[model samples]
Target: MQGKLYAIGTGPGASDLITVRAARLLDKLDVLYAPAGRKGGRSLALSIVQEYLGEAVQIKERHFPMTADATQKQQAWDAVAADIEQDVKQGKQVGFITLGDSMLFSTWVFLLERLSDKIDIDVIPGITSFSAIASQAQFPLCMEKQSLAVMSCTADADALRAALNSHECVVLMKVYGRFTQIRQLLEELDLLDHAILMANASMGSEICYPDLRLIESGEDLPYFSTILVNRTWALN
Candidate 1:
């Protein structure tokens, strides 16, 4: 009997936010794989679901390098995929956990490409950080014919500007590193007052800046930080 691979999303940060559907699968997993960004690093995804995980489930933390080199990153994921493939082929119910939604800007997407054709797979979607942010702030993402755009801030300056100009609401992911540049673009478009900087959405340490101007223009934010730009709503 070939075992199946479960691709699960654990939601943003809070454990209670995890879907009941995803929570039910935790106890049935024989092996749970969690991703670490560097060697000896902790897995945030694992931590989020640790309380609900069954004690009998074997924990496997694999290092998924955070880098720009596509070849290097692929090699690492290839090794991880091989491990998962072997486990599933061995008839062990394997689970790979991802933070937030499984499909959005997730490493799980890359793994799916490699293992989808080889074995049985089940996907369980979880709430995204941006979705949590909107709910927590009581800020509607879009309404009354307003358009919404979700994009990574890692893109070049021109592309960033386009997203701001085009969308009624924009959820800027991975904004910590590009904080200054993103802020400048918002300022250029006169949307600085409409933007909110939030870090660790739904977590205990969550910080929100309803007024983006209060944040230092040159200061980088936490790694989990995101910027919500709502042009139609008065954020400040």
Candidate 2:
């Protein structure tokens, strides 16, 4: 019999926020795949689900380099796919965990595209980082018919400006190294005060900045950081 593959979302840095479905799958899965930036780096996704898994479960930490090089990323994805394919072909239940929703800006997206034809796959959704941060910060994402746009901080400046001008709310993901640029744009648009910057949302070290200008210009942020801009609402 062919084994199944599960792409599970562990939620935004909070263990309790993980869905019951994802937790049950983690408990029973034979092999678990967690992503890390380096060989020995810690995986936030794995940390969320580690307590739910027992000694019988096998854990695999796969390295996914943080780079814009397409060739390097493809090579890494290929290797990970091969590893997962090997376990699946042997009829071993495999599970891959990602922070936030697996369908949203996840490494699982690439893996699924590569493995969809080779094995049966199931996806379990979890709360997204933006939603968790918004909830924790008491910031409303949208209201009535207001539209919301989510984009990466690496997006083109003009496009980002257009988005800010058009949408009532905008979420900029992966804002770690690009905070200064984003802050500049927000200030130019007179939307700086409308933005809320969050780092490690829902985690123990989570930090929220209602005033974007308060953050130092050259400060480094975590990979999990996000900036939520809501023109419809602003802090007093």
Candidate 3:
């Protein structure tokens, strides 16, 4: 029997937010893998779905560091992937859970790259955090002939600014720490009023506030935060 690997997205924050298909698969998975929190803490995804798992099923929590060092991140991811590979080799159907969509800014991406050659990998798409943000904020991403660009605010600020100017809609993911810097740039461009910041979208903690007028400079933000920029054309 060929073992199967699934990269599963748990959606924003709510257990019910997980897709029906993903939920079904989760119930059937023989082994589940999730990134661990600091010092053996349970992953948020695991906690959300813990009730659904059978006692017979196994859960593997892999702790990863929160660091910008490429070597550290790569090593941790590789170790996790190796562990997943070990489970698959033993003929177990493994489900790896991630917050938000598996493909969007997910640690699963690194695992996929590492294990693609050795395992039969399939990804189950879940509603991304941005989708929840848009729905909650009642945002229209883009319209006919207009383009939508989804990127990280952690990237070059100048490049992001250029994209906002060129695209009809810009969804900035990973905008947690750089909110103030990005907001300042937007303010200078007279675009702050047109943008919306979505924090902890679709979760119990979700907040959708228009304009950065209320957000403090360099305020510590959560990982679930995102910023949506509606180009002037979107005002039509």
Which window of ten consecutive residues has the lowest lDDT sum in model 1? Answer: 35-44
Question: Tens digits of per-residue lDDT for model 3 on 1-236?
Answer: 77889898888887888888887888888999977865667677887667667667888887878899999999998888888899899999899998888888887888888999998999998788778887888887888888888988878888888888898788888887677788888778777767888888876788877766887775677777788887753321
Quantify how close model 2 is to the true structure by its C-alpha RMSD in Å. 1.5
In order of lDDT, best first, we have 2, 1, 3
In model 1, what is the error at residue 173, expressed in angstroms? 0.9
CA lDDT scores, all candidates in order? 0.88, 0.89, 0.82
Candidate 3 deviation (Cα RMSD): 2.2
Give every collision pair in model 3: none
In order of appearance, the predictions have TM-scores of: 0.95, 0.94, 0.91
Clashes of 2: 0
The runs of at least 3 residues in candidate 1 whose Cα sits more than 4 Å from the true structure, single-residue gaps closed, are: 37-41, 218-220
Residue 77 C-alpha lDDT in model 2: 96
Q: Write the per-residue lDDT of candidate 2 for residues 1-236, one digit (tens) a residue.
A: 67999999989998999998888888888899988735576777888998889679998888888799999999999999999999988998899998899898887899999999988899999899999999999999999999999998788888899999999999999887888888999999999879999999999999988888888887887777899999989785
**lDDT tens digits, residues 139-162, model 1?**
779888889989898787778788
Of the two candidates 1 and 2, the one with more favorable TM-score, higher being better, is 1
Q: Which pairs, if any, clash in model 1?
A: none
